[model samples]
Target: MAIAKLDVVALDCPEPRKLADFYAALLGGALVDDEAENGWVVLSTPGGRLAFQESPGYRPPVWPSTEHGQQLHLDLTVEDLDRAEKEVLALGATALDTEDRSRSWRVYADPVGHPFCLCAG
Candidate 1:
């Protein structure tokens, strides 16, 4: 008797199309651009569906600080940490925490400042 099932994980951003493209490139998915349908974009991947909603006044959160905490973040697993890091950085992701290279995970911010992690699989 489950009351609900997880459908999609949506993120709010100033530009839905751009955000969707970024995720699509990172995760290997098919993007559905439907800005006319209420400023929403969907990315369909084997893992799941990721959506982006347009928020005109969206403000990115500051991580590790309660003043403006991270609203939420995605944890993406990769086969090779170094390779993934290089790819993501070239795709406009900012390194948030990469000082400790021995760790199993590293943090990075998407182009517009949404923090996400690249974890070793």
Candidate 2:
């Protein structure tokens, strides 16, 4: 029915391993690397696989404005938004957008500035 199965969602970063490590730590995945130093990294989780490749001049997305544009973003479901927010902040995530009364989702940027959201579902 489908042309092909979805394999991986890859991101480009200056250091592939570091980006992969950040996601693996937050999402509970196993980081895998190839023998050759091809600047490729992967994190395999129960839900899906995320990959990272080295980009010599990687510039993070400038969200809110379409000047640079946001190539992609990730939304994660959390039981307690407040608790998860604190935990993610402690793990080097920078809060891009903070919402108090509107308690649905909060925005944050990874260490390298990729936008992601913690959603209460």
Q: Please give, for residues 12-105, the per-residue lDDT of candidate 2 as tens digits.
A: 8888877787888789879765411698988898779998888888999987779998789999998899999999998889998986737699
Candidate 1 collision pairs: none
Instruction: Residues 1-121, candidate 1: write the lDDT tens digits.
Output: 9999998999898888888888889999797556625789989877899999988889998986789899899999999999999999999899999999989999999998999999999
The regions of model 1 sitting more than 4 angstroms off are none
Return the clash pairs for model 2, or none. Answer: none
RMSD of 1: 1.4
TM-score of 2: 0.92
Q: Considering summed lDDT, which 10 consecutive residues are worst modelled in model 1?
A: 29-38
Candidate 2 ranges with C-alpha deviation above 4 Å: 34-36
Residue 110 displacement (Å), model 1: 0.8
